[model samples]
Target: MYIGRAVIAGYTNEKKVFLGYILASMSFPKRRARIDEESIKIEPLKTADYNNPYITYNCMKKVEKDKAVVSNGIHTDVIANKLDSGYSGRDAIAISLFAMDYEKDEYNTPRIAACFDNRSLYIGIIEKEKIIIDKVRNDRCMLISTYNKTVPEEISIKRSTAKDIAKELCMLDYEHIICSAVVCRREENDFEFATEEKNRL
Candidate 1:
């Protein structure tokens, strides 16, 4: 019932990608969110996932506008810094992931991440020494999680809408899932962002 924490990134338009996260799960988090002029925060409800998750993290760091780094731990910052420093999306993800390797938990939980820049989306998982990274185009979605060692994949969906991915986990009859997905698009000179969430009762 524990999938740790994760993010899913995908293209919603020619110039923007939707980035969404799974709030801490399995247990209802006394979750609180704050959105101000400069930032947005979702208090983490997971104290220990695989290895004192609070120590590492399943956090996201928004790099320069148009790019973001999402990972299952502290590496999120590492990846974001890289992107901010001008590294290509793939390189940022790879370099940061390789630097952290995998969490040294009893289960050897893999670190999952997804990143996107102006027009592309990337997903990856680091497990011990094996790493899988893929560049997913704007029209489809790829799935990954931080649980036991397992391969992640890209799957097709009937509706490639914002409401779609948010329902993924909760629809499984899984009680510990808090999911959200974004649907973004770029109009003539601006970007549009739409999001949706589904939390288990």
Candidate 2:
């Protein structure tokens, strides 16, 4: 039951599509950052930080102005590149996850991600089987993570600033929480995405 990474999306009263994530890792270190103008990267820090494992390595890449690929491992780059090459969020997520299959790590961790923008939200998971929630409507967010639970795993966050939600996730008892990123489409007409990130440190 290792659901160390997750994505959330839904609409607020302002009519904005919001996407958020919590990267949890009890085994490896994590860092949250915006590496460049478009890409916001979050991953396990290297020996550069401390001894770590490739099994837990991960990253986030911006697929477009509004869309981003947040994943449990290098698969983030794989999916993000496809998006940069002009694939729609759906096709890019499918093609990338289909090719990579699941992580071959000893844990056999599933590969999971989200393709999120102002107008749409998609969640993709790859394990023994694959499931893609192509579009999560405003009524509620469709959330799936690395491990499947017998009970429903989805939870709702009260509409608030990005930092508020991230902090709320940190308050959870789950010992694996590494960091969180919250992206909201505040601009109604076009893509004007604003994000806030906080590392477990």
Candidate 3:
């Protein structure tokens, strides 16, 4: 199914915290995930239309030693800042999604996000009709998407490494897979990240 941009968070069998972000877009297939030392950003390969504010933004960010935030738009930074400022994962996600509301595009696309630390997991979505922030179990992988799969649901995660987890998420039965990224906590303030783009397959 096509769930648009999505964020997944949970713990691997080894008990390490992991977060994955997938950019599944039919409209912006030319986009790719750019990974750096600090964050992962989704950017268009070429300058097409910058007016669509939702198309380019940081998709994942580590705000603190134990906290990270992932989202489909600019709220990624907003949520991360809130976490950096000492808010709990639940409060940061809820307040950011509530203030940002949904994207103002033609589709009124919902804003989906996940904030996670070593001990807690929170996923949220802000749609035109409603807003949801759910604190989910850290023992199981939970997914939230901008489209059809707007709610958080548990999913199986067989892979443990960052690269394998990212590729596995991109290979899911979802449609229009553009790129995927995974962030895994190795230790306090240490993280391993990897990304997979469809064109590189």
Candidate 4:
């Protein structure tokens, strides 16, 4: 799976606030053998590193810094702790990206699950004791690292919402995969399980 970070608008006590989230993509494993669609299964990801301060605070600030936004009023350490415990161990995060073919409430409150067209990013967290980014290609995704501030900027982020970022990144990744396909292989199998893993260098 590809590992990265992002900011998502979260609600607390009905108050809207921008919260930082560490995002990852979870897909089918490459090393596994495939059977009939119905019989195929994969292991559910387990995580114990939810309280990772480095990911919670640093990931959020990295995205904000890309937009030239100051990381004020953000408790890099405290919020990190919250994310650790708040994690439901859920894989797919259903985020609203586009408008759906549905109506809004009378008060114009948008329904999260129904009224909005959404895209989901699947992910999992590795051991919190150590975060290692490897450069390798697997059936799941390729891990990519962001440029270090102590060094130079390798990847740049444009100002956009999490939904926008997800959609565009998905598209960017799709395009690259399509362009790199071999014609002979294309005819042999349907291209369905494909993804990119972004990581920190």
Candidate 5:
């Protein structure tokens, strides 16, 4: 459980945007049991004092040591799936096309019951709470690959600990490997990302 503020610094040095590259899941990566030699050089950064501005309101307030208002750290989020049970983020946006409501042609459509649609819907519910989800970036983007070709048991156990997996990925790549949620800092131009504490669905 990665419980504190984390700053994942890999190769997201893009001037005005954040990026993520998929890393193979330790248990299911293609051929290799570990990160490829090329992807292992990426580094994870420690977010010092609310460096990432995409955390929960309570988290941001604690970091800022300020008053906690309803909107203290609220913002519109565009959540989308970065991985599937068997794929990585090589072309997440293109892949998300399937998450959209084909009938409505809306990306991250509010209603779709398939597991894939479920992931997109989960993001939508997060937005209802005022978080922003980035759903529109087409073609060849970056992601920390976690779809490693290990064993299913190892993968299940690893996925259970979001913080640890996130930390591991952060340690191996650039850009913040955002989970279900991240906090937006009021003063700094950064974000505090974490998975949702409450995953009802």
Candidate 6:
């Protein structure tokens, strides 16, 4: 299935918090994930495509030690800013998704996001026809995507390390895998991060 872009938030069997983002694009597959000390950005390999709004974005942001935000668009930074400004994970995700609505692109692509802290996890989607925000169970992995898998669904993630988790997400049966980024809690306010690109597989 081509689930476009996806976000996963949950806890590993060891009870470590983890968040991940996957870009599965058929239209813009020439993209790669760039991870820094603070965030994960998806960018086009070709400089000429840098200005294309839909293809370049900060897909995940670390707001604080224990708080992080993940999304398919600019809303990732928006939600992270909201958290930095004192909103809870659920509220930040809900407000940002509501304000951004869906991407105003040719497909009217829905904006999907996830925000999680040490205590809670929230996933949201804003589509042209409706908006849904869900508080997910932290004991298990939950996934939300911009295309067909817009609703949050539980998925098993047995991998406990950030690098393995990223590869696991990229290796999912989803078609046209572009790239993936993942973060796993390491200590109070610290996380281990990794990224995987399908072209290297």
Model 4 agreement with the true structure over 1-201: per-residue lDDT tens digits: 222222222212222121222232232111111112211111122543243222211222211111101011123222223233332212111111121211232322111110000111122112212222121111122112211111111232332333333333434431111100000001112212111222210
lDDT of 3 by residue, 1-201 (tens): 898999998889888888899999888778889897779999988755545667889999987677888899999999999998888889998889898889998999999988885468888899999888888775788998988888889999999888989989988998999999988888777888889987677
Better of 4 and 5 by TM-score: 4
Judged by TM-score relative to the true structure, which candidate is superior, 1 or 6?
Answer: 6
Comparing 4 with 5 on lDDT, the higher-scoring candidate is 5
Listed per candidate, the RMSD to the true structure in angstroms reads 4.5, 3.7, 1.4, 19.6, 18.5, 1.3
Compared with the true structure, what per-residue lDDT tens digits does model 2 show for residues 1-201? Answer: 456766665555555666666666665544554445555566444543644444333345555565666666777788778777877777777898889888776767777777764346666777765455456666665556665431224566666655565566555555566666655555543333333434433
Give candidate 6 misplaced runs (Cα > 4 Å).
Answer: 47-51
lDDT of 5 by residue, 97-163 (tens): 3343222312221211101121111111111112222332322122211112111111111221323
How many pairs of residues collide in each model?
Answer: 1, 2, 0, 7, 55, 1
Error of 3 at 23 (Å): 0.4
Clashing pairs in 3: none
Shift in Å, residue 199, candidate 6 = 2.5
**Per TM-score, what order, best first?**
6, 3, 2, 1, 4, 5
lDDT of 6: 0.87
- Segments of candidate 4 deviating more than 4 angstroms: 1-79, 82-153, 174-201
Ranking by lDDT: 3, 6, 2, 1, 5, 4
How would you encode candidate 1's per-residue C-alpha lDDT over 1-201 as one tens digit per residue?
565565566653342455555654554354432232222244544553342444334355555556665665677778878887888888888898898888886667677888775556888888886898888876765667776424665544433344554455335443455544333334322333333345332
Candidate 6 lDDT score at position 133: 84
TM-score on alpha carbons, each prediction: 0.71, 0.76, 0.95, 0.20, 0.19, 0.95
Which window of ten consecutive residues has the lowest lDDT sum in model 5? 69-78
lDDT of each: 0.58, 0.60, 0.87, 0.20, 0.21, 0.87
Clashes in model 1: which pairs?
57-73
